[model samples]
Target: MEFLDLQLVHALKTDGRAPLRRIASVLGVSDQMVARRYARLRETAGLRVVGRLNPRPVGQTVWALRLQCVPSAALGLARALARREDTRWVKLAAGGTEVVCHLAVRGERERDALLMGRIPASRAVTSVTAHRLLRLFKGGPTGWDGIASVLTPEQRDALAPAYPPPDARAQPVRLTDLDHLLLTALARDGRTTHAALAAEARCHESTVRRRIAHLRGAGALFFVLDIDERSLGGPSATALWLSVRPARLAAAGAELARHPEVAYAAATTGRTNLLATVLCRDDEQLYDYLAERIGALPGVDTVETAPIVRTLKRTGSVARDHDPADGAPRR
Candidate 1:
């Protein structure tokens, strides 16, 4: 990616809905230049800004599933899972023998139907492990650390989103039918014009605009950028599962989230309580990270590294009419 492309991404990460004019002002470039760069990035680099539902704020449960499938069934099963709206980050790991994804469900009944009834009954799945996400130290709405540091502090501050206070966040915001439709359209393209959203939602443009602002302010909605990491020049991507002392789990996870290599970090329930994905420039850098950085972390007992072979899905939920090349929901 060009230096300017990287900066634009960082700005979007800060606030995905920021106007191109505002982004250009922060980057000290012409608004047309920013627009051209964004369009080119989307066309060539597979860049997508998607509005995603924040499950936590809505009383939903999040679980990570690692399914060891028969080698022949791996790709098929990964694609099937990716097609589900409940699954995200679907990947083929452990040399294409494992399908891993994050599952979000509304309640125990919904969770049980998938985790207990459906998944366990699959004949092709050799083994399966489910980990409940207890806390997220990074990723999700926090964004990844890879392109996070590209923008200057002043630039970031200029684009950072204004979130509601804790008191407001504590109350779950009920979503309307229109809200769901609006979000569905935005999921396909976060920068979709307000008029387009209104047409999709079958409502007035002003109403669509107000509802979007309300959802964002209520913490029910947030934006995520899904991009081709290859453009960022990373040669290695590995998933790390760590067993850390309970007393130090939070601290360890927090510290790990700060590392530039970590794309996602969270605390989960299972034998390995912490999970993280790290991207390195090369194998040598990966070794240095494992040997020095991880080795220096406190209270981390054991580390399990699984090299990511391929990603079937990344940041967006797969809509019914999904585009094959990218994970975009059909408009």
Candidate 2:
């Protein structure tokens, strides 16, 4: 990622729906260049740029779980957990000594069934620790900045022509009040039936179906995924930060993104400019991955890692209601 490319990513992160012309102007680049680079970034990075809804406003809860498992069984257990509709994120940590998974559920009963019942049944899991997210300080990786400087204008321009023109007619469908009500209901319980949602929203099932289809097409809704690491027999999960040459960032980041163990990867500001989060099933997995997978990438200068002790809050909701500075009531 060149420094200019990093700037482009930052512009998009600020607003995913920002127009190409606007992004180009902000980065002091031509619209065509911005269009091309963004398209390539999305394709090469496997990144989904879409509107993110506040989970709590829609009535959902997020939780984090830590599991201890035997090294050999780690992959299988992780794969099983990853298959669940309630699991969203899964990571292998500390050489397969731990596995971390994020889940969304409606009530205590469902949560218990997942944690105590299904997880315990996995032959690979030895133990499990679950934490309900109480609050969230921040989530999501930072946009590129350090890499923006390395990209040449022509190189950036080369990336622009790849993007297809935006289709104005294909914009996301508008939601009715009733649709909002139904979405709110389903957000709380992703497994809820259409009839149930319709009843709660005071609409017919057909209306619910059409509205849901519209929301799905617009990327407003998706299936929730859940996983149990204990069953998978993996070790711990860790977060990592890396610094790389601005010119080589795009190629490097794209390479890391392809690793199956990596959960999230993005370009960001700060000392360790390129932020990458990965999951390892065991110590060997982590070591091999770092020593081989990450180390082999071009332009990498330094790597720093920290194990996530716990998640106070996650994607589904805002934990704290007070203001950050004074702790005053949020109005």
Candidate 3:
């Protein structure tokens, strides 16, 4: 993907449902050109602009799972976890012998089936570390704001959602089967039109629009824009585990969110209360970020970094493990 495509991703991150013509106007390009680039990206980059439910207000939880196992079982386990609907991200780290996954915990029954029943029974798994996310200072669309500078202030404002504070309380919603159908369609393709969404959900277009607005208002749904990593400097990724005092976690998370280098960060359970992913050009730059920036933060007890050797899956999109610019999966 080119810089223009990256800017397009930034625009979409702000408003995934924005019309191509509107985005083109902001990017100062012909509407046709913008559409062509998006088509190419969808085909070549394997990008998915998907919808995700907000779990916090719904009595749900998010946890980061770290598994250290023999090298032989690493990829197999990572792929297996990625295939499950509960997992949001699965990464092969520690030079391919370790696996890190994000679990969106919905209820105790679901959690037990995953953490106790299914995981412990797997063979060759040496260890498991579960980090329950207590709070998320920045996630989803909020975490991608650093790239918004590509657009002018007016363009940015135009793309903002009419929905109130992104932090609005989310009451749990028991979606009907029809509601799931609509949301699933949006998750597969957020740009689907009202007509298409209505068809998918077997409902009227008016009903589709009304339900979508309700979901948004209840803070039950949000969309995520997954841009190609090659456009994001390089493929080098790291997961940081930080030990911060319980009282200072909120402040620490807020401070961490301001750093442009932070791709995602949240407060978690276990010895470390914070887990963050940083994207950099290379190891040297990553070291500089850790030493000069993270080291400078107050109340940071300890910081451990795990470079992501390969991402098995991210937000339901499969990333190429080698030669990402060519968009080929590693063999």
Task: Report each candidate's C-alpha RMSD, comma-separated, in the order given.
Answer: 3.6, 16.4, 2.6
- lDDT per residue for candidate 2 within 223-287, as digits (tens), equals 33112221123435567767889898778877876666676565655455566656676678889
Candidate 2 segments exceeding 4 Å error: 140-331
Give a tens-digit lDDT track for model 3, residues 118-206: 88888858888888887777778786544434777787897777774344255567787877888778877888999988877777999
For candidate 2, give the lDDT.
0.57
Question: Which sections of candidate 3 miss by over 4 Å?
Answer: 145-148, 165-169, 318-331
State residue 202's C-alpha deviation in candidate 1, in Å.
Answer: 2.8
- Model 1 misplacement above 4 A: 145-148, 164-169, 317-331
The C-alpha TM-scores of every prediction are 0.91, 0.48, 0.92
Which scores higher on lDDT, 1 or 2? 1
Clash counts for all predictions: 0, 39, 0
